[model samples]
Each structure stands twice: as C-alpha cells, then as structure tokens.
Target: MITTTGLTKVYQSRDREVTALDGVDLHVREGEVYGVIGQSGAGKSSLIRCVNLLERPTSGTVTVAGQDLTALAGRGRRAGAELRRARTRIGMVFQHFNLLDSRTVLDNVELPLEILGVSGQARTRKAKELLDLVGLAEKAKSYPGQLSGGQKQRVGIARALAGDPQVLLSDEATSALDPETTRSILQLLRDLNQQLGLTVLLITHEMDVVKTVCDSAALMQRGRIVESGTVGELLATPGSELAHELFPVGGTASGPDRTVVDVTFHGESASRPVISQLSRTYNIDISILGAAMDTVGGKQIGRMRIELPGRFEENVVPIGFLREQGLQAEVVDGDPAPKTPAGAPAATAGPAGTTAVPEQTAPPVKEAAK
Candidate 1:
C-alpha cells in the first residue's frame, strides 16, 4: 500500500547539514500493519512524516495506493491542492493527542470532514459514528482537557478516521500513556486494521508495540533501515538483531559448561514440541534460559534460549534434528559443561514467560526478502 525509493531527508543549518534519512527504500503491503522502529535519533520520525508529505523529503519518491505523493506536492514547503486532497485519504495519529482543547470530542472529530465542505448534519452523524467506533460516543460532548490520556487518544483516532482514509499513519500514538493504556491503544489499532481493512504504517520506539500489533517491521539506525520483514521471517533468522531486541532475555548464566542454543519457532514449527522431542530423542537434559512467545495476527511466534548438557559437537545431532523439523536453532554457548544440577527441572520460565538467555547482542541486518 505504501512504497518509498531512495527516500532521503536532509536538514540544513546555517553551518551544518544533517541527513535524517539516507537513501531509504521501503515497502508496506496492503491490508497489513507495518511498524518502523528505532532509537530516538534513528530517523524513525522523519520516515513516517515523509510517508504522508507532512515532512517533505529532500529527495526520493513516495507512492501510496498507486498515487505518487511527491509528484502531487508543491515544490515549496506548502502542500499543493492535489497533495492536500490526497492527504484526505491518508489519516495520521500523533504521539501527542493533538486535540483542540477548545473543541468538544465530537467537534474535534468533525473537523476533518468539515474541511471537505461536509454539511453540519452529515458531519455530525458521521462523527458520532466514529466516536462510537472508538468507544467514546458517550464522551462526545467532553472537551479534550476533560478526558484522560487514553480517552483523548481515542478522540484522536476517531478524528483521523473522519476522512474515511484507506491508510493510517501512527506516530508513536501510545508513547505518552502508561503500559496498560498503551496495550489498549495498540489493540484498538489492530482492531481498526481488521475492521476497516486499513493499511497501517506506524513508527514506534517500543518493540512491544510492534510485537503486539505489526504483521511486519523495519528497524532503522543512523538514518537507514537495517532490517525489514515479516515477524516470522525475522524470528527465523539466526542472530537477527531485531529479533533479539523484540524478545530480549538478558541475565547471568547459571552454568558455564552447559551448551546454550537460541531457537526460533514460527508457522508449523511453533505448534510442535521440538524442545521436548529433542530431549527425548537425544536423551540429553535441556535447560531453558529465556523465552518470549506471542500470538500475533493469530499466529504463534516464539524464541527460546535453551541449554544442553554438552558442547556444540555433542549437541550437533539434536540441533540438526531441530533444523529438519523446521526450527532455527543456533548454538549460543559452545563450551563443554557438566550436567544439570541434581533435581533441577529441565526448564524454568524466564521473562515474558519464555526461558531467558544472557545478553548476546549483534547488529541488525536488512530483510533478505526486501
């Protein structure tokens, strides 16, 4: 639904030139939720803003729903008529709620339709329906200042949909709220993506948000996308930095001789008991370090760090067995080690209900599929 080629954004100061985006190319498929993630200086904000021409790019092209937004936009900072009209079909939600404090919730939502010369009665009816959709119909008369942060964000979502947009751009829409509120907002976006068939392109610093909602994700660093792909593909790639970040399991290891391996499970492999089968087949005890399991878009995606009672050579057969079963098993610990302590369970739950592994970081890689 959205594509960018050589998308670069450069900012000029009196004595310096800074590039926020560097020859970036991205593709977000239709009817899917695509997440852009990075640290604060990673150019994540610039990329999303460029998508809708909110921050006009210094170079490159943006195509959405077959329309070239860059071509339709004016050469200057101000958007042209065609670009303005095109934007109506592309809605945006901000990190801050960006609501009009003076206007009531219903009035705030009606503003977008009003700009299109929609009649008062028609816009009012449409606004109410949107408010109901976001579960805020009863608060239509309340002003922005009177609502909680989550409620205000709901108002923002309702307003963004007032234009009946086909694409929704979320700029850290839940960053300001608490964890519980953040989950609520993310779930709402997921629901809207399914109900309206809206193609969502959101940028966030939080991996949890992406883990919970995005069908695919891109990782940005130093103004370039280092990784981009479906979540499953990322999980399946060994030493994927994005995958590691998404399901972190950092801690001190309890044993040095134990052979540790990180395994990724997705698709059919996620349903199988590969870990247990490995232990039974090899007759070697397995120790769980850390794990993260999530059901995204109704698919089970999981990453686990496990330890076997031997060196890499001794466990090669079991790892190969796991690979033949469609699991990505990479040995993280290779040194030979003593057997598990007496009476220790084969595995224990770690953070996020997955076994934990000590921190072993790596640089993010671009999606091979891209």
Candidate 2:
C-alpha cells in the first residue's frame, strides 16, 4: 500500500520555480494495480520518483506499507541508511531499461543483490529464479544488447524485484514498446501483481494500459489529480471527466426538439438489452448517435449517446427509467428541462452544460524523466 498526503514537488530552475506536484494526495490499495494517467508535464514522473525518494518531495509525506519515508533523517539528495534500507522494500521499473551494456542478463538482475552484499552463489540463485519468473531464464548469458526491448524491460523488472519488494512503482514501463510488446509487458505486470500480491502504482499516458490492467486509476492534469476512483465507480459517476475519456462517445442533437443523452453501462447493465427495452417500453424511437465498448478490469463497460423525440422536460421520466435500471444517464444535449422529479436523477443541459466534452487530440509525446 502507498499513500501520499499534501505531496508537493517544486523544481528550482534558472529563472522561475517549476511546480511538478501540486499538493497531490494519492492512495494505492494493497494488492491492487493502480494507474496514474496524464499527458507530458503532468507530474507523473515526479510523483513516482518521489515515492522512492529518488526525487525528494519539496514538502509533504510519503508513506509506503505504513512507513513514513519522509520522516526518516538524511537530508540532501542522498538518502539516509534507514531510507536506503526502506527503499529495498519498494521496487521501481523504469521506462527505459537502464541496464549496463557489459553486464549479462543475469548480472543485471543480480546488481541490486550484490549492492546489498548478497553472497555470489545466493545472488546468482536469486537472479536466476527471478529471470525464470519473468520468463527470461534462457537469456541469463545474453547481454543487454542481445535482448529485445521487451526482454530488456523484463531484465529491468527482474532487477527491481531482486529485493523482494512489497510495492512496485512503474514509471511508464511500457511507453517505448510496440503495441504487442506493450500488451505483453502490461500482462506481465498483472501476472506479477496476482502472483506476488504486489501493490503496483504505475503512471502512464496510455489509457489502454489503464483499461487493461488497472483496478483503480487517477487522472493527472497540470500537476493535480483531477479525478480518481475504482474503474467501475468512475464509469457509474455522473459527469465524470475520466469516465468520458475512458469511453468517449461523440454526438450532437439531431434537431431542435430532440433530446440527446449519454448513457454509461457496466456490471450487469452492460450485458442487458437496455436500449431496446427503453425503446419498446416507452413506445418511443431511440436514435443512437455514437457508442463505445471495452473491457476494463476484466469486466465489460460501454457508453452511448442517444437521441429522444422530445425536449428534456418531456423525457424526465424516461431518463429516470434509465437510472432506475442501474445505468448512468445524463442529458448531454437538449433544451433546458424543469426541476427533476423527486427521486429521479437530474438531467444536465446540452452543449451548454457545466462540463462539455473536449475534442479528442493526439497523444502527447512522453516527457523527459525528472
């Protein structure tokens, strides 16, 4: 488990101070894969570095497995002996496989154990076991240059696990790999999490990574966590920016009188023919404008934008019907509606709603590691 409270990291540039983390309070539960997603310069790199005290936080506390690392003595860049020993319990996997060119695969994994004064035979035995765990046992004699990108990352993972850490911090570990390799690496992380009961806190810009393996996730923007929760909770929340980003559905009202609403489906509701039921039950035609479906945390989730043949006021009961069925339905485009009926979910206004979905943009380039 990991928890950070009021965590702030400020960099002293030549001219002005750069605030990388702005009072971020994050919690990653034990034995769960948590993901932090954001574009470049969103403090993702800084956050992970702070977790291991690799980049000391300008202020606030960093707690891992009930230990307050920031409370340990040792000032300056170098950590104290106490902090150093504590770090051995927290493993870190980097985006770039920071392996020595000259060291063989087994040697790279054994580096941490050697630093810990592990005996030669013991180190080799532990390293080989780790190599086998990461499916790289046969590459023990191969050098860093001899392995593929995925294999090199596996070496990095094995090296991180040499100390048998309880927590794993991944700093964009799959960013540099191709899609296939990225999927494989992500699957490996999931496997490790399940097999070792490792508490994984990974930061990535790719939503696909979060969708595939994360039990919970946080969205970072401008150095702050804008949204965070269990994947299912986020999808079921009304007006959740992270939910919209995770399953984006685009559409506009077809005509002036028509009302457009966005519906989120997950859990039992995802498999039901709710749309067809809505159409037949109300005897009203429904036009689907846009839809997206995907599996998240081993469960199906989907979102859809649909149009109804009336103003928001006329469709209040119909919208309420959706909420009663355990679906998150909100008016995304429609004329202003009256006060929602008692016990009925409120309908948000049209494009003029409080939160308008932003246009999709290309993924930003990965930021330089801080």
- Cα displacement (angstroms), candidate 2, residue 276, comes to 0.3
Error of 2 at 156 (Å): 0.8
Off by over 4 Å in 2: 73-79, 334-370
Q: How far is candidate 2 from the true structure (C-alpha RMSD, Å)?
A: 9.2
The predictions' CA RMSDs to the true structure, in order, are 8.8, 9.2
lDDT scores of the candidates, listed in order: 0.83, 0.87
On lDDT, the candidate that comes out on top is: 2
* lDDT, candidate 2, 1-370, per-residue tens: 7999999999999999999999999999999999999999999999999999999899999999999999873665555888989999999999998999989999999999999999999999999999999999999999999889999999999999999999999999999999999999999999999999999999999989989999999999988998999999988776888888889888888788887888999999999999897787778899999999999877899999999998766776666567767788877744453355455444444333422222222122122111
The sequence of per-residue lDDT tens digits that candidate 1 reaches over residues 321-352 is 77777877655632333233344323333323
Model 1 residue runs over 4 Å out of place are: 75-79, 251-258, 333-370
TM-scores of the models, in the order given: 0.86, 0.91
Report the lDDT of model 2 for residue 181.
94
Q: Which candidate number would show the highest TM-score if scored against the true structure?
A: 2
